[model samples]
Target: MSVVKMKLNGKAVSGDVEARTLLVDFIRQYQGMTGTHVGCDTSQCGACVVHVNGKAIKSCTTLAVACEGAEVTTVEGLAKGGDLHAMQAAFKEHHGLQCGFCTPGMIMSAIDIVKRNGKNVSEDVIRRELSGNICRCTGYHNIVKAVQAGAANM
Candidate 1:
């Protein structure tokens, strides 16, 4: 086992993990943060998306050992003082989620999109950028609206 240490959601965290352990596995199984879902192991589904060093990445495709000393932020880190993040609040107000399986990843990716594209993100741009995240429900219409609204708030 390899000992990996990193800043998780603004807190220092360390755990022993196998060399082959995925970052998602380390976060969910070892760190006990289940907000990062594993909808697809193939990395096609963005359910395991998280912020690594302030950038969004598919956790399933990333290795835990590779993230040593990195700053990781899961869905659970979005909220502060029991209040939802702007993106999260927008999702709720806009009904962006249905089954909720893809909500976490969607939120994480949306935040990154807004950060990169700025608050005035266009609908076409949001759609194009969200190609990686797939939501079986809501057909992405509400999700797009939520992202736009969340972007404005952020």
Candidate 2:
């Protein structure tokens, strides 16, 4: 076994994992956090999205050891002092979610989108950028609205 260490959600954490352990597994199993979903084992879905060093990436395809010493942020890390992150709140306010399975990844990906595209991101840009995230519910109309509102608040 190898020791992997990283700053997760602003807190330093370390865990023993094999070289083949995926970041999603490490987050859900070793770290005991289940907010990061595993919609598909493959990278086709963005449900396993997480922030590594302040950038969004698919955790299901990333090795846990590859993120050693990196700053990783899962969906669970977005809240602080019992308040939801702007994106999460926006999702709730805009009814961006239905089943809630894809909500976490959508919020994380949306935050990253705003970080790269700025607060005034367009609907087309949001739809294009979120292509990797597959949402079977809600048809993305409200999700786009939530992302824009969240970006403005962020």
Candidate 3:
């Protein structure tokens, strides 16, 4: 087992994990943070998306040991106090989610998109950037709207 330490959601966290342990496994199993969902285990699905050092990445494919000393932010870290993050609020306000399985990752990725593209991101750009995240229920119309609106608020 390898001992990995990092700042998780602004808090220092450490745990022993196998060398092959995925970051998602370390977060869900060791750190007990289930917000970062494990959808495909492979990198195809964006459900395991999380911010590593302020950049979005698929936690399922990333090794826990590779994240040592990095600052990780899961969906649970988006909100401050009890208020929702701008993206989360936009998702709720725009009805972006239906089944909700992909909401967390979608929000995380949307935040990253806005951060990179700025608040005035266009619809075409939002849709293009959201290609990685898949939502079977909403068909992405609402999700696109949510991302655009969230970008404005960000």
Which candidate achieves the best TM-score against the true structure?
1
TM-score of each: 0.99, 0.98, 0.98
Any runs in candidate 3 off by more than 4 Å, and if so which? none
Q: For candidate 2, lDDT tens digit of each residue in 94-140?
A: 99999988888899999999999999999999999999999997799
Cα distance off (Å), candidate 1, residue 146: 0.3
How does model 2 score by TM-score?
Answer: 0.98
Ranked by TM-score, the better of candidates 1 and 3 is 1
TM-score winner between candidates 1 and 2: 1
Which digits, one per residue and each the tens of the lDDT, describe model 1 over residues 53-126? 99999999999999999999999999999899999999999999999999999999999999999999999999
Query: Model 3: what TM-score?
Result: 0.98
Q: What's the distance in Å from true for residue 55, model 2?
A: 0.6
Runs of candidate 2 with Cα error greater than 4 angstroms are none
User: Which candidate should be chosen as best, given lDDT against the real structure?
Assistant: 1
lDDT of 3: 0.93
- lDDT string, candidate 3, 1-154, tens digits: 9799999999999998899999999999998999889888778779999999999999988999999999999999989999999999999999999989999999999999999999999999888888888787879999999999999998
Model 3: per-residue Cα lDDT at residue 132: 83
lDDT at 139, model 2: 91
